[model samples]
Target: MSENQTIYAAFAEKLDAVLSALEMEGTLPPETNRANVSVEPPRDPSHGDLATNAAMVLAKQAKSNPRALAEQIVEHLQRDPAITSAEIAGPGFINLRLAPHSWIEELSAIAARGDDYGKSAMGAGTTVNIEYVSANPTGPMHMGHCRGAVVGDALASLLEHAGHKVTREYYVNDAGGQVDTLARSVHLRYREALGEDIGEIPEGMYPGDYLVPVGKAAADEFGDRYVSEPEAEWLPLFRAFAVERMMEVIKSDLATLGIQHDLFSSEAALQAAKKPEAAEAWLREHDLVYDGVLEQPKGKTIEDWEPVELPLFRSTKFGDDQDRPIKKSDGKWTYFGADLAYHMQKAEKADALIDIWGADHAGTVKRIKAAVAALSEGQGTSIPFDVKLVQMVQLLRGGEPVKMSKRSGNFVTIADMVDEVGKDVVRFTMLTRKPEAQMDFDFAKVIEASKDNPVFYVQYAHARIRSILRKAAAEDLAPSDANLDLLAEDDLTLIKQAAQFPREVEAAARAREPHRIAFYLYDLAAAFHAFWNLGNDDAAKRIIVAQSAELSEARLFLAEQIGQVIRNGLAILGVEAVEEL
Candidate 1:
């Protein structure tokens, strides 16, 4: 096997060779489907080092009992030098214990590929466009947008590490009514900046002080010229100015969390280019859209409702709850109409598309998916698209719900959270739970130094290893792979835990869940800590011994490799591996 090939990949190839041999010998039928065959670590460590279900999955095609097929597969597997023992367990599950040299070689591989370890080529030759953290350009980024931002950014890094060309995108919703309100609110602040003594902010206008800077900038640029102007005269100028300034603020806030996007597509730009009109024309030609009137809304009295003719898309044809409108009665494009055009624009540049959206947008997922499917089928292109909904994160401090931000006069802002707890703590804590599950972000609990804090636990593990290396250097002892034979069973056990990083990376990338990386790091840290505790009971079990420099050097080599794996995993998650607590 090549030095760069992961241990799991090597074993999987061996398993496939065994199956091919059976086919060639006529013991199993020719060209049997082997898609379901798998090689992975057994759930019970006592079972074996590796296990395969090739016999159980292929038994029917081979026309033999599963246990009988297992015997034949084992007979071929036993011939390999790497396999020390092969045993058949319940229901034809074949378990194989490997020679200790296999793991020792993997430890050497970890040293061979320091920073590049755990990366995979599974996503090669594909381009993925990931749209995330698209908060409306109305105010500063609050905690509401934090979870999706971190998840999307980490997933983008994970995909890139997995060898896909990834494009990070942020959609700017600047052409909405909320921005109009924002303009009106900024006008008041502009008047105040011009010494007009504008009274309390009225209802329906944004109340955040974060917009004051935009207003001050507007006043500085336009002077008293727009102080007494008509709403129609100043609204357009203020709207554009406010949106631009607010996006700047949003970008600064995202930067504090280490997030930056490759592109910022604008809703107003889409409208200005008439993309929605083109989409409607194509849908009409395909009979996917037509002029129609919606049924009266449910739970509304007839007197309280009125039907108006609108252009509707046949979303129900693709399993939506109902046909959705593409245009309002006033002939303006609806949100869905504009969004459909935006997705089509993205599809033009990538092989696959993924949107990281808040859970509140769950209701509109099906219609957008239907539109994309219709577009892909009509255009004769295969584009895989997915919408990952991130559940809400509740902010708390000392077990009580946190209050609103003084600056925003609304929810807590991302800048505030990052300022209070720090970037690493915020990013890592957000990923400790699944994106689809609601979680609490407690200020007091996340930074605690106990093992319960996963971020600290993982960092402490890396820091401890670094401290050991430094101490060993002071004693004139250094790590050396020359005496790897001196490593004991406890040392190899730690190596086994570190070797799982490659498999974890591939699995997490395939599942599109970056939280798996966080979970895996926590487990690896726990195993390292458990092994570190053994040296406290017996002086000979420690990594450094004054009398036995050969054994000490070999164990130091093992420690350094473990630290490297932790750093590689943390890099994929966008968390720094601290060398000191």
Candidate 2:
């Protein structure tokens, strides 16, 4: 099927032409704002198959009453070959009832396109860089980082599906005090591995037992070579070793959930390349940074409150609450300063940037957004930057919370979840709801073969379709040369629901909310399920109609198209559409 064959696309273009014809007739003012004009399904299906607000939007500028303009527009729309009838409903809304043949043609197109049906050109090859799950490489990825990981990866896939060139990236935070602590922790384990009884791990160090293997590996590679050395002699060597090993563990965890990043940008490497200093110099020269003392902080009082001059970015000029300190009094760069440099680098490479962060970073969004805006302004380029803050997820079993704490080393890791529930369950369950909302992942419910579980329900819909196909094959009946026009109103309605997949994909990508796709698939599955159940009450409604092979083939084509949509949607969510429940 050609992309332009989509009913919605055809109608939008048709409406555009109607408006142009109106302008030529002098009924509408020339060059009226058509940006707000939209054609979509009416809220009430009984009202119309499609609705448009073109007349209402251009009425004011056209020096005509909305309802009066709508009546004129309806006249032109009625002449279209696809539109069976057009009526002016309520005020200025034009309700259009499309020909049944038009929808039959749409169903045929969906069947012909199959999995590629919903693919859109919305993104238009725009470069979108998504930085997600840049977890500190101090330990294995835990349940806390699960939501962002799945959400980020799903959003990346979603963007690509919507025709964007997406770069799935991970910003490995291999710098600063966190990695240093990890290095020290590994050194303690190394000593223990070398026959030194380092009893308990000290405070402010990782206590997870996963690092014991790292210690053992280090001991095996360099036996007592770094045991007697000074701290400085072993710190860098241990830091590099620990970071690399922890990243390996992290990578394995991500892979278990089908996540792979294109690039892992490092903070230490960014500093080594002098990006922070270069960004700082640019900001200072632009008068966007200056040495200033901020007023007393609000909300919470600082423990050591003292007025000291420090270099600050004028974040307030770009909508932040106050000027943000980019450098501390001790002459060390703050995280925001380094982030500015990182975003600047991203701005140089991509036309758009997106960051998936934990909700704890909600307070920091304004400053980062301001930084991006400043970078874009200074560079004289338009860089679309957005931050998605994913909220926490609570693990549950039958509605009761499962305890997890990363500090105590007893926290649930991503590997733990994947091991318990399959990766498909983990990925699909994580994306069942919006990331901004807190959700509970119930171990009991996700794998259950009931409608209560969304993943199972959706997969069952696809499986149900496959079941029909198998029955048809056993009967030697193929799903071809069938007249799709033979489908009933309910069957055609089901196909209409399937046709919404492309629209939903674009909406999910444009909003940067991959969870919407999950919800859409759930609804589409439910629609298919309801249509399938119709067969239970009436034998004629089933996909494999033994009495009528042509009808069965038509129904099979419809079922397969629904299955294709479900498969495409699951692909975006990084889940497999199971053929068998």
Candidate 3:
């Protein structure tokens, strides 16, 4: 097999050949739909090295019993020299045990491909636009935004590794009411910078000390000219100034976490360009938008509720609970209205769109999805869109919920988290669980030097491998695949574990979940550690067998490839694989 072709891919192709041979001999119908057939490692490792469900999925179509079909398929599969045995298990599952040389060849491929071993062309010819970490441009990034940021950024890298053209995007919500509040807050700070006693912050304004620099900078630049101006005259100027500076702070915080977006789309710019107006007009023309009055709000008693005619999108036609308003009573666009246009704009630039949003936005996902579906149908194209809701991360220091930061006042800033725990720890910890599940980020637990801590465990595995290599190098020994034939079954076991990287990459990319990479690395590390422990009981099982240089070289080569795979996985996760502990 070519170095670029993964072992699973090679076997998948071989399986296809066997199926085709069966077709040619009139055992199965020609042009059968084999989309449901899958090739993967069986859930029970003792079952076999690889398993496929071809006979089971195709039996009904082929007009034969599944076990009979499996018998025929196994006959063709066992003919291949690389396949040591093909067994029919339970009902119709075909499990193939491969010769050890096949896995040894995969280890050689891992060494040949190096960093590009697990990368695949599965997403080739696709352009994905991923918008993430779009915290309102009013303050520094906080812990609330950290999880989605890491998830989105890692997913972008994962998709890129899977061969997709990806655009990392951030939506700057500078046009919202929040920025106006930010402007007023900065004004108070600016007054304080001019030595005025502004007193305690007002009830409805941001109190973060992080904005003090923006206030002081404004005072030094403008020199009290805006200090005396009317609210109307200064609101626009201060709002723009504060947003620009706050975005700088946000960018810097993201930088500390090793994140940078290719595009920072501004809601104000989108509005100024009249994109929402155009979308409203198009939807209105197609009867998707109409002047309608909504029922009274639910679950709350409104003493003076009154009906008002609004331009509402017919989201109910596409699975939403109710039709949604595109415009408010005051002739301004609703958040959904603007967001719909934003997604439409993104859809124009890419074949698929993914939005990483906080769990708080879960209520609006349906309306937005409905809008995208309607718009895509109107445009005569099928654009795949997904909104991934990331749940909150509760911060803890010592088994107790951590208090809010003094700088941000409301929450822990991303900078503070990065400063407390390194970037790799924060990033890897955020992805340890599925994004939809709530997690606790306990400082004491995260940094613990034990196998229970995934970051430390995976990093230590790479470090231990490097330590092995260094000790061997100092003794005039280097990794040599020339003696791989001397490797034992235990060594090939680790190779089988490492060989799953490519399959995992494709599967994770298809599911749009980057957490799988972290999970896979942990398992791979456990397998390596298990093999390493075997040497503890018997010195001959060790990687560096002084009595046999050939076995040592072969084992060292295996160790080197395992380290390479770890480095590649960590790279996708934006984590560092330290060479030493």
Candidate 4:
């Protein structure tokens, strides 16, 4: 827990004690529970710093008017030294106005904590596996994958910062029919590299020019050897060559977006291993594996749905809609079977798993969780697996949707998007919205030099601080806080906002929403900008002046604090915070 957490917890304990004392003395009615009481910042500033709903929540059982109960609660709380005053407001809301010294003390605590200010043990060293950017190696990532990549990376960073042992992983699905198609496509490219005509691409094959180079290398390596070979003879070789090139391109593309994974698990390697068989063996030992025929799924009819008995997994035993197939009638494991093994690996390696998947896989959520639960056999019982579906990103340019049809060979790659907007703007805009909500990224709007461009607005705030620091250094003023209390109302408003940085980080981390950090930084930057503009109107409000070097140092100290918060926030999101525009 953090200092803020410690303080709030102590306050809650004291409040609980007060309620217990009242209950024991029979000053309150019976059966009034106090467990749900909470202290949080009020929505309205005039209501005071923190507000509690204790009286309102407990009023019915106490058989007293909420305001009366609030008054009784306030009389007891006002005796505490930490609380300056407690007022019973409308609707029995108990509003607290802490001593100004308390705010100063919080600021001091922040200064003492420094970079560790918002660190928390909320996760308690639990392991969380975050799988993201498992984009098919068919082609380079597009704008849609970019948003998920940034969101996942930022979320992992936030989780780690909040005390979870996080593993950033990328799943490579190289065993699917898509790889077979890629192999054939590369063959055509190899023929083309041999100066063959190789007309239009066949249907159901990759048409992108990206595979041309891979084909050329393959042809150079084994000129006429595979020219007359059968499909089976060349398919595996072609797949290996194509996937290696695809992974290389993917690594470069991810580098452009500043994303690096801790692990890149290959589906083919896992399938080829005896692991899934071992997993099946484990399930068999638990009596969860059997032979059965699955009824055809509704909503879609498979033309080849012949009722044939096959090895099945008792997924419905855990809570799936029905029993699922582990192997097809052809004696090959189905895609879902491979997924079961992957999840089993996750369950064995980590205490918790978080899969960042595309919205298209939303229906797979229940079955995946069910498989993990069934496989664990109630030992690692409540398998806390969460799936985050990152909605699509509509890319726009000049107020019009950018046309990107892959069939036309004009799809936007992540590299192109990052190059157009630059990495900082790309990272910031991608995080400006929650993963659950679809986002719109207007290329024109993001590059604009206005408030609508959150990236520029926030970066400008940091740049302005650097500018002020430059001015301070040129004027030979110290940056330390010799007399930070000299801050005026406007100055202290900015300082107080900065003081909320640690709390904001903790909240954003716990909520698993890094976008909250982005939004908070924008709000903080707006506050600093308003303060900076005020100084432009009145010169005495300037950050640096000729007299009272100690006061100047104090204001500079506040500016440095604001800059540090912005820097840390941007760093978590993997955006660069440059000192100059």
Candidate 5:
């Protein structure tokens, strides 16, 4: 495994050096900031290999015309042997073209490092705590958590690849009311398991048949002793039992998607340790909490809305809509208060924090961010925090909506979706679109082996390359000794696309969005597929040349590099790279 930094970063650094030299020579004023200068690939490939806005960004401070400044920067940049040509484009933009050898060397770096070719040290081993799929242990993880799980898992993998010390955590909401309801529901099933007809489960109670096994397990463990037991006696024991069993089911479901968190922090455990109360006291000392009376909500208000003096957090100080209550009128901690405590605990050990939540929790992001800011400030440390609100996925089959689960009355499960298409398809399709966008996962379209399906398309690119490489090796023409210089222009284009993997990975990790990698893989795969078809139209563009063993090896080398990129990308996505379709 190696972080052979991409040529892009290398060029950017070289350009920065050039700017520094110009600064020393007084071509630009002393101590002139070059921070805004950017070196990146041009929008049109025909324009150049790399483009820079150095002159445009710095011309004003230097008191020179943009074009003249660009020319001066170009003079210094062209001296770098790898940069074949640099030209001034509209107004002040500089376009650059690198020697084909630069790309060829980059391909060699990729082939040498294999799957770890694009790994980066962007995070520098910072401890990043990502809380995701903290679903209620009340039942099996369903479609609601499916996207968040995949997204979180991919983000964790991305972070690790970028050299972050990542903690994949699931904040179990065991202390919440939903778990108590689950306990009652399981007790009802326990009676049924003991030969009592409990009839229809009551409204507001989880009525899934999935709880039947929990009930039966309880019955088998400790028979009718609980049958005549009081609610107080059985509630706690059943809640514990049901939560454990449901977590088992949830873990099994996550395994089907190849997801396993490193930690499972329980709210009950946090509360038992007095973290919430401690946080409240800490906030009070910091003057972030106050006793306030709130007005009734507009229009249809909360049923129990009443004027009362309760503990409230100054959430509006951090962009929240209004000051939020930290304690209810009954003198109990609000959910927000407990959540703040949980975040405070997380903040103690983390340099950065991320939470993946369902879209319905969108309104809660601001207050939590505010709480984190307050907590970090009190501790005299800056702990960054962000929340990703994943939108709902509309399940479709043959263009018709597939709504509930047959076996359980709750939502369709992650297990069912994984079982239907496949783990790779499930994970990949969940990320084909941005998390904030509502996407329809159509069963028929996703399973189709066509360009329209990104997973299949990307996987097919790798599979096809593998197939060709195997055939080439059968003829004893390996790519190792081939002169990569013999590759066609389009092959170099494909190589350039592959070389961008490191930059893409770094950007994706920095942005905390793994979907960018998914999108990149799809584009690279499309490029590879298009290059393969070029051989169909023109025999000269084919990988295996009849008379030239050297050229055949060169093409094979290109294919190997492309395949490596696809595999590396899929690895970050937590999806398998199939060798054959």
Candidate 6:
């Protein structure tokens, strides 16, 4: 347990004793535990250092007026040495003012823990797998996939900090119809590379010139080897080679943003010619096999729509709107069947699963969850999964939305965005908002060095702390002598803020939202900046030029702790914390 957590626990113990004493005096309920009572800072500082709702929550149960109970509780708490004083205000809130040394001790805790201050073992030894940015292997990643990549990667980091054994995985759709189209697209490029006049790309296929390299590679390997072969003989070899080529480019693009996955599960590998029969047998044994016709979706046009009964999965039994076909009337499995088999494999291998998908897949969440539930025999532990849907990011510049078209081959790739803004700006901007809310990424504002730019604000805080430490060293004060008692007022305020790191990290990790960390770091930086401004007004208040070396050491200790907290928080977001920005 952390020092702050120990302090809270001790406080809870004392509060329980006070409640018991009050009950014996006929002033409150005898059975109140006080265990659920929370000690937190009030948003308004005038209320006091810490406020508790113990009296308020127990008022009706104890059959006493809340304010009266608050007064009695305050009187009991005042006996404790850690609490200097207590006041009751506004309908029974017990506001506490802690001893100055208690705040100093919190600073000592921060100084001791340093960069490892906020790490927690809340997750224990549980294993979790996070799947994200599983974009099809048909082309390079675009801006559409950037946010999910960052969110998933940051979430993985946050979970690791919270002490979980986490695995970051990417599912590659290398066996889908999309890859077939990619093969055809590359075939056109191959002919063009051979000096054949293939004027314009046909409709319903990729038109980007990025695949020209893939075509060249294919020409080098085959050398007209399949020129006279049947489509069945040549198409498989082309599809496999084309997908392999695209994946190389995709990996390079992901690396540009400092993103990497621990595992890449290939769909083709799952449904290989040798493995497909095994999946079919498993589905049959599980009673997921059936023959039923699915109602045509009402709003969208389906080019291959037909009314026919075929092999189906009993998805409706698991809460889907209707049973879905696993195989079409043409005796071939649908994409959903492959996905079902893939999830079954995941369930067999992992304890927990998390999927980060784009918001366009919102309608598919319930069905996927239902399928997993049924597959796991109603034991959610076997296939526990949560889908985090990241809303789209609209690219903008100078306050206007930027537009691009893939058909015209003018679309912006992830590499293009990274090149323009650099990886740090792109990543921090992506994480500044919650995953579920739509965010606008403006090229103009993201690079600006202002408070509005969270990335720079946080990095600047780190740099400022380094500057203070440098000044302390120049004044001949040892950087390591930390007399924590001299830390008071502005210095104490920064230390107390730093102590909130463990709580903040636990909250953010529990919620699976890394944006909370981003916001917390910004607030911490604001507090540091306010303290920095004090140096300009009062020379005595300066951290380095204080009257005694002890005072300087204490202030430098606080400053170094601030830097560590900033570094840890930014590291969780996968952003760099430089000594100088």
- The residue ranges of model 2 lying beyond 4 angstroms of the native Cα positions read 1-4, 297-304, 403-408
Which residue pairs clash in candidate 2? none
How high is the CA lDDT of each candidate model?
0.93, 0.88, 0.94, 0.82, 0.90, 0.81
lDDT of 3 by residue, 1-581 (tens): 88789899999999999999999999989998889998999999898999999999999999999999999999999999999999999899999999998999999999999999999888986999999999998889999999999999999999999999999999999997899999999999999999999988999999989989999999997899888788899999999999999999999999999999999999999999999999999999889999999999886467778789999999999999999998899999999999999998998999999999999999999999999999998999989999999999999988899989999988899999999889999999999999999999999999999999999999999999999999999988899999899998899889999999999999999999999999999999999999999999999999999899989999999999999999999999999999998
Residues 86-163 of candidate 6 have per-residue lDDT tens digits of 988788888888777877766666666766778888889678889999999888889889999999999999989898
Worst 10 residues of 1 by lDDT: 191-200
Best first by lDDT, ranked: 3, 1, 5, 2, 4, 6
The TM-scores, one per candidate, come to: 0.98, 0.97, 0.99, 0.90, 0.97, 0.88
User: For candidate 1, lDDT tens digit of each residue in 259-308?
Assistant: 99999999999999999999999999999999999999989998998899
Q: Please, what are the lDDT tens digits per residue for candidate 5 over residues 305-409?
A: 667898889989888889999887776678899999999999988999999999999889999999999989888998899899899999899899997997678
Best of the candidates, lDDT: 3
Q: Counting only residues 3 or more apart in sequence or on different chains, how many pairs clash (N, Cα, C under 3 Å) in candidate 2?
A: 0
When summed lDDT is taken over every stretch of 10 residues in candidate 2, the lowest stretch is: 402-411
Q: Enumerate residue pairs that collide in model 4.
A: none
Candidate 5: regions farther than 4 A off:
1-3, 300-305
Candidate 5 lDDT at 70 equals 91
Better of 1 and 2 by lDDT: 1
In candidate 3, which residue ranges exceed 4 Å CA deviation?
299-303
The positional error of residue 335 in candidate 6, measured at the CA in angstroms, is 3.2
Candidate that beats the other on lDDT, 1 or 5, i.e. the better one: 1
Give candidate 6's error at residue 349 in angstroms. 3.0
Query: Clash number for every model?
Result: 0, 0, 0, 0, 0, 0
lDDT (C-alpha) at residue 201 in model 5: 94
Q: Cα RMSD (Å) between model 2 and the true structure?
A: 1.9
Q: Candidate 1, residue 155: CA error in Å?
A: 0.6
